[model samples]
Target: MSRTVAMVIMGAFTLYFLIPIWWLLVAGSKDTGSILTTNPLWFADFQLFQNIGDLFAYRDGVYLEWLRNSVLYAGVGGAVATLLAGMCGYALAKYRFRGREMIFNVVLGGVLVPATALALPLFLIFSEVQLTNTFWAVFLPSIVSPFGVYLTRIFAASSVSDELLEAARLDGAGEVRTFFTVSIRLMAPALITVFLFQFVTIWNNFFLPLIMLRDESLFPVTYGLYAWNTQLNQLPELRSLVLIGALVSIVPLIVAFLSLQRFWRSGLAAGAVK
Candidate 1:
């Protein structure tokens, strides 16, 4: 395509994606009556602050609890998942081990299997183990990301050199020390990518938490908002809470993406090299 045509196409796609966010931003700032009556793209009464205050103070500030739960699940879980994937991927890349190809193939297969497909089986097993409706039910499952492992393996193979590992070893660095100092350093960008991916996945996760957690205190933001949405008729006041809550929920994801964008660029470049 011509440059002009490509630019136009890109602009169109960008607008398509951004329009909803724009609408959400506009909608969240308006009162419930104006929201139902006004044009979605336009604003009326400025009630964003009021909505936010109400959002935070609603139902004994359960929204804040839900936010905290999401952050814990996403932030801590993502970091651990990223580290584990890095180690596993690095091992697969560097070591000549038995069943290496088979293991990798199995992991690749796992990438194809959607998480929703496994949720039922996981719930059944967790139920049998008597661990359902607890924090562990959602958190334990969120830490495993097959795609993260796949990406890390590709990054390790391309970015981390055998020469560097050998040099570290010759300098009397132990396996773990060398890995942390040399390999993980080189793999920082890729690891960040894995972390952000896992973080977003866990943050936006709904069904897993929905099925696993019966307690409102344990509900993540997504599930909590969904519950509020279901009660829109009974608790019409919750409409404002839901809208404002959604806007707030997305803030972290946006901040995270923007903050880590530089790492992503470097990581993509590294991944592209080999």
Candidate 2:
């Protein structure tokens, strides 16, 4: 009975998340006029490819531009954030130095602080420095993931061995070399976890980018979809486009998760065995 209940609960949770995407898939395949009237979970006209073509053709292929911007912001920013977090976390885990605990505590505190609260302050600071409303405005903030640092620190503490560092040093590997080679190998799962979280966070981020960027060209998919959404009443046809864009926007995230699922599963399995 307990196992049955657990399976039911799991199925319910799965459906809860899947239902919205399912609706989008079905809706994207329908025409603008049919979207509101037709079954949201079933295809009507089978216009998915046609709709995709229109979406790409709209505004001289602006959707593709938004896609590129999103890749740049999330992909590049997440990679840099993960690298920095891994290095910082490794240092915090392996080295004993003055103010190490204090610095670690500060990073943990940063994790607890809401990112939204920093938006206004960041805006004002950027404004003062003449950096607002530019690529740096959004890209700069996307790379600071305190939670990534915290998680990486914890993982580094357990996953990496101090004896290995000593052995590497004796073998004439410098600190940077040792970290890039030995430390990163052992902490691969943790770094991948950090990159995934940071990537998704940047990809889905709305408020900070919305606050910083006044130009549509720099807007990521989240903000771009929002802009389209706001004008849906003016252009009812935009509603279908927005839904399709929303569905398409999620594809990259799905791809990333699917591509990394093996590593993620192995990480979980390793943790369980340990």
Candidate 3:
């Protein structure tokens, strides 16, 4: 009876989460007129393709530019962040160095600090250096992931054995070669987790870009959609475009999660064993 109740509750939560996506699909498929007139949860016309085309073609393909910018920021930033976090975490886990606990504690503190809280300060610092409105402003900050560091540290400490490192060193492998060749393979699941988390965080980040970038070409898809959304009164036609853009924006995230789901599962199982 308890198990059945839990299943029913889980199903309810799933539907609750999926209902908005269903509405976005249905609403994005309709023209502006149909969207306001028809049922929001059901398709009125098959205008999804047309809406997508319009979204891409609008403003001389500015939406595509935004998407490209998002890809650059998220993809590169996530990869670099994962690499840096992995190295830092691995060192903290495996090496015996003075002030290691202090550094780890600081990283833990960083994990506790909210990103939004840091945004204004980061903006001020960037402005001081005259780096605001540049790609580096957003990209630099995105690459610093405290949670990623924390997670990687925990995973590395648990999964990577000290004996393995000693064996690699005994085989005449230097620290750099040992890390790249041996440790990285052992920490693949944690690294992937860090990459995905950072990727999604950078992809969906809005406030940082909102403060850092003035160039429309530099805006990520999230801010671009917001820019369109804010102009709904002036250009009511943009309403449909915003809906379609939002719908399209989430596609990459879904694809990334789907592709990397196996890694996540394996990471979980490894954690359970460790």
Candidate 4:
């Protein structure tokens, strides 16, 4: 009876999460006519391809431009953030410098501060620098991830060995050489984690883009989809396009996670072995 009850609960939770995705799949397959006439949860005519075609053709493929901007922002920002985090983390873990603890504490505090809380100040700062309504306005802010720094520090301390650094020093490896060759390899899993986290965060970020950018062409998919959603009142055809666009936007994220999941698993195994 207990086992049966547990299965029932698991099934219920699974359906809770999957139902919306299922609806999108079904809805994307329906044409405008079938969408009104047929059951929303069930498949109508397979217009998924047609919807995709229309999505690209909408407003001269503005959605595609939004997707490109999102990819550039997330990809570049995440990479830069991860690199900065890895360097800072390695320095904190391996070196004993003046005010090291203070710097770490500051990063910790930054991690605790919500991004939304900083949005206004960031916007003002960017505006002051004449960066508002620009890609750098959003990308610059996304790259300075305090949480990524913290995670990298923890992972570096655990994953890397001080003895290895000492040996590298004895072998005439410069600080930079030691970092790239020895420390970075050990910190791969952590770097990957930081990259994935920052990537998804930047990709999904809406409030910052919304506040910083007024140009629709510069908007990321998050804000672009939101714009479409709001226009649904005037343009009912946008409903299906928005749905398909949302579904399309999720694909790259899924691919990124799947591609990086191996590192996470390997990291876990290495930790367990240690």
lDDT, residue 274, candidate 3:
55
Per-residue lDDT of model 2, residues 136-185, tens digit only: 99898888888877777888888888889999999999999999999999
lDDT digits (tens) for residues 88-181 of candidate 3: 9989888899999999999999999999999999999999999999999999999898877787788889888889989999999999999999
Off by over 4 Å in 4: 1-11, 266-274
TM-scores for all predictions: 0.97, 0.96, 0.97, 0.92
Candidate 1: residue 149 Cα off by (Å): 1.1
Off by over 4 Å in 1: none
lDDT of 4 by residue, 183-245 (tens): 999889878878888999999999999899998889999999999899878988888898889
- Per-residue error (Å), model 3, residue 91: 0.4
Off by over 4 Å in 2: 266-274
Ranked by lDDT, the better of candidates 2 and 4 is 2
Q: Residue-pair clashes per candidate, as listed?
A: 0, 0, 0, 0
Model 1, 44-96: lDDT tens digits are 88888888998999878999999999999999999989989999899889989
Best by lDDT: 3
Model 4 misses residue 21 by how many Å? 1.5
Task: Put the candidates in lDDT order, highest first.
Answer: 3, 1, 2, 4
Of models 3 and 4, which has the larger TM-score?
3
Instruction: Judge candidate 1 against the unseen true structure and give its global Cα lDDT, from 0 to 1.
Output: 0.91
Worst 10 residues of 3 by lDDT: 265-274
Predicted structure 4, TM vs. truth: 0.92
